[model samples]
Target: MTLFFAIVALAFAAVIFMQQPKFGKMPTGDRLERIKRSPNYKNGAFQNLSPTPSFTDGANFFTVMREFFFGGDPRIKPTDTIPHVETDLRNLPIDEQVLIWFGHSSYFMQVDGKRILVDPVLSGGASPLSFTTRSFAGTDAYAVSDLPPIDYLFITHDHWDHLDHETLKKLRSTVKAVICPLGVGAHLEYWDYDPAIIHEEDWNQTIALDDHFMAYTTPARHFSGRGFRRNQTLWTSYVLQTPSMRIFIGGDSGYDSHFAEIGRTFGGFDLAILENGQYNKSWRHIHTMPDEVLRAAADLKAKNVFPVHSSKFPLATHAWDEPLIKIVQAAEKTDLRLLTPMIGQVVHLDDSTQVFSHWWEGVN
Candidate 1:
C-alpha cells in the first residue's frame, strides 16, 4: 500500500511539474481538431511514416540511460572552448543571400530579401533545467537580442532542444510569424503569440509565403513532444523555395525513403541543412547515424549538405567532434560539396566556391 501511494505521488508530482510555462501546453480545441485531421495522427498520437522504435528492438530507455551514465565515449563533450565568429546578425545586409549557423540545428538565413530564423535555441541550455544539456562554451554567443527582426520563424517541432520556450518567449516581439508543424502552435498560443500569425501545417501541404517564396511541409522520421506524453504534435521537414534558391530545412530526421521522395518531388535542393549529430545505434531509427547522414544527403540529391545537430549541446554520448569528422570523411568520397562553416560564420549562398577551413581540426 505504501509503494502504491509513493508511485501515485510521483506521477502526480510529474504532472504538476509539466504544467510549468517552460514545458508548454499541448494542442486543444481548434488546434486539436486540426491535428486530428492530419493523416500522420494515428491511434492516440502522431505516427512516423516509417515504423520508428525509440530504441532498437532489444534495447530500451533503461539500456540508453545505462549507456549514458556508464559507457559513453570519454570525450562526450569538448575539452576546449568551441570556436566561433560572432557575426552582427542585426546588421547583415539583406542583399547578400547567406546562412549563418548558430551551431547545432539553429540557423538564420537571408535569402531573396527575407530573414528566416529556424529553431533558435539561444538560451545557453537545451533541457527543462538550466543545469542540464548546457550549451558548450563559446557556442551560445548569439542571443535573441543580436538577431534582426525575424520575418519568419520556422520551428521543426517542439523538442526542448529545438523549440525552446524561453527563447520563443523572448523572441515574441520581434517575430512576425511562426511556421511550424501542426499542433506546435498551441505552445506559441499559450505563450501569448497571436493565433493569426501561426501558420502550423501538416506534411505535404504547400504554403505560399509570398509571390516567389513557397514552403512545402514534408515527412520526417521522428516524433515530437515537450513534456511526458509524446507525439501529440507533428514532426516535419520542409522544402523551402525562394526566388533563386531551393533549400531543404531538414529539422531532424533519421535516414529514410522520405529523402528520395522529397528530392524527386522538389527536384532536389541547392543546400540541404540536415541533422548529423546526437545519434546512436540505440535510437538509430530517429537520429541519422554518421554514415547514414551522407546517404540521406545523397538521397536528397543535394548539391551541398550542411551538417548540424552537433557542436552546441551534448545531447548524445558520442565524442563532441565525431559528427563533423565523420561527415567530412564521408563527403570526400562524393561529388557533393559540404557547407561546413564555423558557428556564427556566414556562408554566402551566392558564393558556392567559398571554402571553410577545417575549424574543428586541432580543437580538443
Candidate 2:
C-alpha cells in the first residue's frame, strides 16, 4: 500500500515538473484555429504524408523501451571529446557565403547576403533538464552570444533538441524573423516572441524572404509533439532558393516517396542538409536508416549532402560514429559528394569542390 502511494506521488510530481516553461504550451485560441485549418492537420493532430507507424514490425513499446534504456550498442558515446573547429561567425565579411555546423541538427548559414540559423540548440543539452541528453563534449562550441544578429531563424519543429527554450529565449532579441512549420509558433509566442515576426506555414506553401530569396515549406514523413499528446504540430523540410543557390533543409523524416516528389518539384539542390544519425531499426519508419541516407540524397538530386543529426546527443543506441562510417562507404560507391566536416568547421558554400576530412576516423 505504501509503495503504491509513493509511485503515485512520484508520477504526480513529474506531471507538475513538466508544466514548467521549457516544456512549452500547445497551440490555443487563434493558434489552434489556424492549425485546424491546415491540410496536414487531421483527427485532432498533424498527420504525415505516408502512414508512418511509431515502430517497425516485431518492435513493440515494451521491447523498444527495454533495448533503448538498458540494452543496445555498447559505444553509445565517443571516448574522446568530439573534434571541432571554432570560428567567429559574425566577424566574417557580410558578403561571404559560408555555413558552420554546431553539431547535430543545428547549423548557421551566411549565404546570399543573409544570416540564417537553423535549430540552434547550443544550450549544452537537448532536454528540459540539463543533465539528461547532455551534448557530447567539445560540441558545445558556441553559445547564443556567439551568433551574429540573425536575419532569419528557422525552426524545423518543436522537439526539445531542435527547439530549445533556453536557446530560443537568448536568440529572441537578435532574430529579425522566425519562420517555422505550422503550429510551432505557439511555443515562440509562449516564450514572449513578437508574434508579428513569426511566420508559420503549411506544407507546399512558399514565403518570399525579400525579392531574392524564396522559402518553401515542404513535407517530411515524421510526427511531432513535445508532451505525451503527439502530433500536435507539423514536422517539415524546406527548400530555399537564393539568388545563386538552392538549398534543402530536411528537418527530419523517414525514407519515403516524398524525397523523389520534392526532387521532382524543386528539380535539384546545390546543398541538401539531411538527418543521418541517431537511428535504430525499431523506429525506422520515422528516422532514416544508415544506407537510406545516401539513397535519399540521390533521390533529391542534390549536388552535395551535408548530414547532420548526429555526434551531439545520444538520442539512439547506434555506435556514435556508425552514421559517418557507413554513409561514407556508401558515398564512395556513388558520384554524389558527401560533406562531413567536424563539429564547428567552416563549410565554404561557394566552394563545391572543397574537401572535408574524414574527421570521425581517429576519434574514439
Whole-model lDDT per candidate: 0.91, 0.90
The per-prediction tally of clashing pairs is 0, 0
lDDT (10s digit) by residue, model 1, range 1-364: 9999999999998888878999888799888988888888889899998888889958988999999999899888888999999899889888989999998899999999999999999998899877899988989889898999998899999999999988899999998878999988889999999998889899999988878988889999998888778999998999899999899999999889999999888888899999999999999999999888888888889998899999989888999999999989988999989988999999999897899999999988
Instruction: Report how far off residue 48 is in candidate 2 (Å).
Output: 0.6
The residue-by-residue lDDT of candidate 2 on 1-364, one tens digit each, is 9999999999999899999999988889988998899888888989988888899978999998899889968888888999899898879898888999999999999988899999999998888777799998899988999999998899999898899999999999999999998889889999999999998989999898877989999999888888888999888999999998999999888999999999999999999999999888899989998789878888999999999999999999888999998889988899988889987788998887899998888888
What TM-score would candidate 2 get against the native? 0.98
C-alpha-based local distance difference test score of model 1: 0.91
What TM-score does each of the candidates earn? 0.98, 0.98
Worst 10 residues of 1 by lDDT: 49-58
Where does model 1 exceed 4 Å of error?
Answer: 1-5
Candidate 2 Cα deviation (angstroms), residue 7: 3.9
RMSD of 1: 1.2
